[model samples]
Target chain A: MENKENILEVRNLSINFKTYAGTVQAIRDISFDLKKGETLAIVGESGSGKSVTTRSIMGLNATNADVVDGSIEFDGQDILQLDEKELSKLRGSKIAEIFQDPMTSLDPTMKIGRQVAEPLMIHQGLSKEKAMAKALEMLKLVGITNAEERINDYPYQFSGGMRQRIVIAIALVNYPEILIADEPTTALDVTIQAKILELMKELQTKINTSIIFITHDLGVVAGMADRVAVMYAGKIVEYGTVDEIFYNPKHPYTWGLLGSMPTLDTNEDVLPSIPGTPPDLLDPPAGDAFAARNKYALKIDTIEQPPFFKVSDTHYAATWLLDDRAPKVTPPADIVKRQEHFNKTKQG
Target chain B: MLDKDAPKILEVKNLKQYFNVGRKDEVRAVDDITFNVHEGETFGLVGESGSGKTTTGRAISHLYEPTGGEIIFEGKDVSKLKTKKDEKEFRSDIQTIFQDPYASLNPRMKVKDIIAEGIDINNLAKDKADRDAQVEELLETVGLNKEHANRYPHEFSGGQRQRIGIARALAVKPKFIIADEPISALDVSIQAQVVNLLKDLQKKRKLTYLFIAHDLSMVKYISDRIGVMHYGRMLEIADADELYAHPLHDYTRSLLSAVPVPDPEFERQREIVDYDASVESDGKQRKLVEIAPNHYVRAADDEIQMYKDRLNS
Candidate 1:
């Protein structure tokens, strides 16, 4: 794992969207790296800029989106500085994105087989016969049964899960180095979602493609991620390995998120939901974006943003609670008990 | 605990909802299924997409008339209601909260008017001023203030809009509410808020609920009893805890195993049960067999014995 090469490096990335109202600071200064064959999950609620940060890697941000600062280095080249022509050359061949809704992401008029083949033809410049054969092969790879017959069918012909499989087949047809799945399974059911996540992980072993799985579901994150980036109001509030973030979280936002989710073992009537809404990105927050909702926020948190305090070699949390001068604070009892339960089970 | 002797508020006996019936391309959206929601208890119907949980909810709410079987509401067979007034009375007794908050409410109407629509239709309030007051009270009851009455649905956030949906549902003072994936469209933080709100309202009003959702954990938290559905058929039904602890049917087991737990270590070590109903059922006609007190599973005679043996084990 240590020897694996860094495929993508995002350093101090900030972005804004110019709307009629004003410029909305969508992605605050956030930094993270993706290893060659690892899955890095970005977890956050809606409008927390999790999607914006990941979409920036593929240069698929909205037309009004502005990259105000920092760089996204894919392989060795900085993607932000690249022109549309250069970005287009790298887009589907080197980096591909699978969006949430398969119905909307896929074309209604186009056949499923042809849609999957287009990327191969455009990226690798394969002939029609070659591309179609490869498209059928990719469809089979995604566990689409009767690929021979179903490949000719349109997107509407497939069910929700089957359509998502087609979308994945299209994204992975060219063997892209990085696969950006933005809530790919959110539209599917729990069983289908498990299958899709399993499929993605299985494909990673075969294709060795680095994945950026963006979703708000912590349960999904626990299952799929090698490393996790917990986003809050356009900024990464916590970043660590999956175990580190779940077992030894430092950020208040992460604690709230972990506590809010009702587990199978939950006996309580009401979950402790994170109070208040996320900060408005239109004006953006002055100090720490999460300070308003954070229960253990310090005075400095409301006035000045805290730096990323290193917890270990792989873990970092952007909160004043991690500061040496700040008073000691602990996560909720349920979270601590869950960690303990896991630890005990691991030991036994 | 739910009252073991409590009367069933709503009883669905072998309910079937089929689309394009008597045609070559007939689709059985909901197959023969039976369940009962006791008075003052929440009945959670859970399944994957295309499993017809929503269809069942709609059928029970009379949004879509069932193709077969009887929906008996409080000792009366509702599908057999002859007069329009009888049907209207039945409707006012049972209301529904849709999945998508954004699409459920009218964009052109003000929040007050939307909430008052139910009141005006049922003539629940005497005058316009009384209706407005009732609307405001409903809004405040759902955590929104009276000031939010005049604003349009577009002016509110997703969570606020969902609250308005709840308020609208409550406006009719219905005895039962079918919340079909009500919190699924909301964000994680707001989901809890909505679920808690629903729970509080249920306790306060002693309202019976048919809570339908795909999210197993949330359903478990809110429901006293749960029924697992697959491909428009009931797989298992039991106390939420019992169902979670000892899932009887293969489909139920698979559904439970598929739900991702938040513990990284547990999730990594977890075993996912993959059950394809078509393959497992072996094309046998299923019958609901009660293996334990108030616990039911759909299985053939041989499978029923197997389940009973497994329960003892």
Candidate 2:
């Protein structure tokens, strides 16, 4: 909660894509903070701007995308104003990024060792020999046993999970203060996903680095994140500590997401979907972005978008239902069931 | 892996699908693994990407002929069948639902034609109208309307396209089908919808399925019996709930422990740990052993020793 604890902060961040058809508002006044040595996971369905929000921080937004407003302040300095060259130094040095697909992120033509060494070569001014040695060390750090031999192998030679570990190694080789992982485990199988998460968690502890884990899987969020920000239609629908976001959920959209999780407690017969697709960012609907889909949408919810109301010290959600004036509504019955199931599971 | 009593709709025993790579070592993709799908049962085959779950599914469907083992579908030895007539008969009874719904469906073909292709090939329908009616019925069965039959494969969401693929599979009226992680590529919410649709269709059509996936939770939900595979071998097999409740195998135990529960209370409580170190401890080895009725597991030496001692005593 302390100002000094905030490693990265986004204030009223708004991003738009200049498409051939029309300007698409991808991120609408989204704001959140990542504390030092902590992970802030922005969770959402596809096109929820979860990836876009983090992508903006690394200055990795699409070519057509424009940062119309807001500032991404990192280490008390606004990174948005930094030039491409300055930002280039900051990227993969002070701030590193791990993409969704490791296969694509890694260069197939080059040796995995050389690909990892390139960042070290450019930023740290290390010799190829030193960079290669450091790269092998990093690969070992990521739990790749035969790092020395495997370093010579191409991305195609490695498995999906192994490829992801290689990507993690590349990201962490720079020893960045902030490592932004965008759906790092989505491409992996569950066991492999678990391994990747574990490696990241272990490495996070070892380095004491801040991680901005951007993922749609709330299940993964529970295991990985210290803080969770639920994004919907270019907005931070809910933001809180992992416990608050998952256990004592305030937002209906959050509840819907939790309910949709195919856990043991979820009833086999009735599977709940969010009812419809995410709103078109090209022309987003006025009021709460989730209003149309929300079954418990209030009269005001359809007319006015709600500001984030405080639930706990570190918890807040942008839903009128959280408002005192907005009638007191309980979360979905299934979420309560999940809580009970969780309680029983933990108790035993 | 083949059960004795039950009528095996599809028996894929010791199915080995080896892909010869460049030089050095031949990739043992689908090693000696055997399983049988009883009539009206969903036999779940689950593993990681390189674990050969997809290969096993493909081998069962005869999309790729197994280099070893027998694929006895409804009574015929699919792998041994050299004659075209026998292969055609086998293909008619066995169908496949691929992972990528978008890529798997023919872009140029209309939905009607896509579904009706199998029927036309097999001559299941008497005439064009009969085939149209059959296609429409198949469409309705998979949650798509008959009117959408004229639409192309491109004119649908990922979920709808999967449904069309399901429709295409169901068109041949195959008693058995292999759904190769059909829901993995879909959205989380959309995944359940498709999973439930598969379950519902299985019940209504009295269809047997070889549902292959890496998701334990979804696999537990839809499968009658779940097979946990690692590397190229099935580590455990048990009734859906039983497998989750009492995972006997070391690999299965580790796998279940690895699955991140969605609830923060549970998720926060359980920190996932690296497994390779544990698996390699003391240079121990484990073998797949049946411990309970209709339940088999790969146990460590210590566990196996205890079992052996108990059995001898």
Candidate 3:
């Protein structure tokens, strides 16, 4: 239904983690697609399988995590069946990754130039000198002003924001087709967080690379996402365009997420959090896991998982409330009022 | 807006907190930053990472010695206090709530003992029964059950752990507090819960807070008057409403512009501040002056000249 430019497609993906406690189902029957040059933001609270889903794409999930079902189709090949040798060849060259902490992702002993050139050397078969020059080019591409000089410095010499930029440069060094960023800016300050998000959007345009952006911040989702998939208890309960998720949210969990966001406009109101915590993934419920905490949960929601009902052409939600047989329901009046209030004040 | 009728609880003038790195040059973390906490009001100190917001908070609570300036608390000069007894008395009056609840709270101890540690040391509570009663009252005030005092901080959620931190601060019965980025470490959903709890507690206790954080949206949600700092200097300090509605300084405006509006439609169309354009000429050399009521800004000489020259052009 998009612009005939699907780069990556995930179908009914299920993954389980072999922890000492038990087999933890981190991802459950989740499916979504990333279009060329578009951002598909996977927004969820911590431990909601947002990162696990992306990590699975890169085959970077811990050894304990087993991909139980479904397939990830990338450039016409199923990624689930790839061996480490194959995955290694594909990773950093085709599916580069930028993780949460830039410090850990970067090597302490190595120079920044050598680290960025690692992918270029391995993937492009370029010489050390050529790769180093290309690494410095990538550094400048991500807006490092004095990239040529700073290439010799270690990762410790850079600030948090600068380190994150270096990570981005490394992620894009091989000119990857799909860039997977796992909470890349969560550790940064808000101002720097904004700059990085803006840089990502700018970089995506220049390279025409599809991005799988994973984060818990709705603020960042608002700034850069083209499509949003709301995850809850190892499942994507809502998948839609940014407008549908923000303006006409169907899932009750999405409502809680939207309501929890604190804005300058929400000055005097006592910010509401979702009543209870997310359901335990170790022993997840059969039906909608969100029913336990959802104030607007229907009986059907508790009995059986709702099908992906169409709200609009490109928007769908796993909620029974969107059913034609169901009675009409509206979001909390406070939510409606807050949306209007935010709209007026949010614009300059 | 506050009990302007009441006396000032904490007043800082020309406060300076300088740190010497390996070399001779000093990192002026808090350089000549001035602000005051009314008898009861949440005065927010906001900035990005290196803006010295936490340093200012630490200096205000006397955790760090100021290189120069005066800290007058309740009509006494805190900077001039030399004796341990006087400093200990000052410490009792102004407590601190650190950012990481896990790092701040002693993991080995139970919540009750942790809360009781300060009061017991200072002899704020006379008897064992009095100490237990005070702990219970503080626990209940922070919306925790009386039994929660027996449990360790690890047992509670992030928001609950922060509440325990709050209860600990309240145990000593401090009038003025420096809550340094209390909720920045919590989850996004739980951040609102903690912010609301802090606001409710502020109303109940009439506590004056020097709330320090990196998030402007959150700072706006909590602060009465906001002081913005950049590169160790107070860039701007104005009423929260006025600062957000009309940020005067280019740097302040740029900071405000960076705060992502949490609406999908608005975010796409919204104009983000370009880091290159805003601070092109000014690195660390920006002259700051108060242009209006409680609003100060820093800009390079060329930028200042350009502003003047443009107005005349």
- Candidate 3: tens digits of C-alpha lDDT, residues A196-231: 888898889888888989988788888878889999
Local error of candidate 1 at residue A335 (angstroms)? 1.9
The candidate that wins on DockQ is: 1
Q: Which residue pairs in model 1 clash with each other? A: none
Which residue pairs overlap in candidate 2's backbone?
Answer: none
| Candidate models: Cα lDDT each | 0.90, 0.82, 0.83
Model 1 lDDT tens row, B1-313: 4787889999999999999999999998889999998999999999987889989988887877788999999898987889988888888889899899999999999999999898888889988889888998999999999999999999888999999999999998899999999999999988988988999999899999999999999999989999988888888899999999888888889888999888887888878898866664477777789999989998887788899987887
Candidate 1 chain B least-lDDT 10 residues: B276-285
Comparing candidate 2 with candidate 3, which one achieves the higher DockQ? 3
Where is the poorest 10-residue window by lDDT in model 2 chain B? B272-281
True contacts kept of each: 0.80, 0.58, 0.76
Worst 10 residues of 3 chain A by lDDT: A337-346
- Superior by lDDT: candidate 1 or candidate 2: 1
Mind giving the per-residue lDDT tens digits that candidate 2 earns over A287-335?
A: 9989998999988887888998998788998888877777776667787
How good is the docking of model 3, by CAPRI class? medium
lDDT of 3 by residue, B1-313 (tens): 4564667788888888888944589687877777777788778887778889888777777777688898888888877788989888888889998899889889999999999999888988989899989999998888788999888888887778888999888887788888998987787777877787787877877888888887778888788888888777777777888789877666677788888777876786778665444453345565565556555556566556554443334
What DockQ values do the models have? 0.80, 0.51, 0.60
